[model samples]
Target: MSPSGNQDSAPEGVRLQKVLAAAGVASRRVCEQLIVEGRIRVNGAVVTELGTRIDPESDLVDVDGVAVQLDGTKRYIILNKPRGIVSTMKDEQGRPDLRRYTREWPERLFNVGRLDADTSGLLVLTNDGDLAHVLSHPSFGVTKVYIAKVEGRVSAQTIARLTAGVTLEDGPIAADKARLLSASGEGAGSLVELTLHSGRNRIVRRMMAEVGHPVVELVRRQFGPLHLGTLPVGKARELTKLERGALLTLSRRDAGDDRSAGDELSAGPRSQ
Candidate 1:
């Protein structure tokens, strides 16, 4: 039997799936399945719950009876993801993943959220599960800023309709902020900046389509306090301390200050 530590070591913490992923066993979704199948043991006892938490260093975790080392350092990476690479840890169709983009890094990491394989720019990767969950959750309202080039002119009426709200097949969708970055003519295509709080699948594309202006190209320039800056496509850089702290504060505010929930919420973008 693996030796156990004081209960103090088991303070409420990151999800079990995230911890397992950071330990380099597999992705979070796979780890959740493993937990459900009773293939994981914490301190020698099988644990099947998805939300179980334990201290990384003090807890003894064994996957399929093999001890797993907990990662000691939190990792945050910013990747200028080029189109074609999937924003996932693994792909069933055998497509290239973000791992290929960060192959040179010593520590393993996972993406904060997914970007469609066809659309890409400024994808964040990290080994910190808490940060990932906080950043990805809709309730957190982390503002995502994107630049889109559409097929035809986006009229002032279309802009008003977008700002007001539009109903999609999925539901009603609205932009927190939108402005014409540049335009050619009333009938010519233009560039626009869209800031949104929701991270729905293909949201930018769908929103533009709803407004009768299908996107010709899309690029995400910012997420929360982080920016793509001048990072070249397919390249990655480590996040600065100030950036991480600001993200943490934003997450805290988003999590609604329920210290027990361990996630925070922030006042996100106000519609303008």
Candidate 2:
């Protein structure tokens, strides 16, 4: 038996194929095929042996270079946050906070990133600190898309300026994409969608104001691979298998595209 494989008929841990199936990677047969083709890695080492066993709670597993979450205690939640709720778990100021969304879950979940009290949309709550760090860290370049209702008509020239880039009091910034969804006839308001990788404080609002359109309201519609997708305001749901895989894959690619998941989490802070 390989050192990473079972020592005897009574294996120490669960079968590698069984674990992958349980995590919804594939059916048992397909998982075994993947292992045979050298596509699966356990604890950063490729294991082709059929009887390999891994501690689901502690072992690191990846399928075709994408991280696979095996630990059941780690909770991942998607919340369609409503306005007036703070992003924090517990507020020192005693204001409305995120605790209500996480109170039912036994695990101590916290928001991955942040949204201001007045701005509301998709917010992730999770107990996985490494996942949170990977998602929120500015240097990872995970893009966020926002829909803003701003004052006055947004002209094409303004849109051009936004996409080309704009300079704020603090520094220069640009939208990865900027377009006017709709503009009211009598300056009622305009809906503009912008995609950017910035996590700067009130960045969208500041950018609009600098471009001569002050924002009346803002809503984040998407973050990285996750979308808000009709999830009702103030409601939360657990991540589906596909969603989890997509996120882990993105995190894996972001961490220099070669290191193990554990190694990426253990490394020092990324350069800004």
Local accuracy by lDDT, each model:
0.76, 0.85
Where is model 2 more than 4 Å wrong at Cα? 1-13, 37-39, 42-47, 55-59, 257-272
Model 2, span 1-272: residue lDDT tens: 12323434454667889889998889999999999999987656677877777678766678877779887788989999999999999899999999989878999899999999999999999988877888999899899999999999999999999999999988899999998899986469899999999889999999999998999999999989999998999999998877887787787667654454465344211111
Q: After superposition, which runs of candidate 1 have C-alpha atoms over 4 Å from their true positions?
A: 1-72, 185-188, 256-272
TM-score of 1: 0.67
lDDT of model number 1: 0.76
Candidate 1 on 154-205: residue-level lDDT in tens?
Answer: 7787877887889989899989989988878756688889999897899999
The TM-score values for the models, in the order shown, are 0.67, 0.86
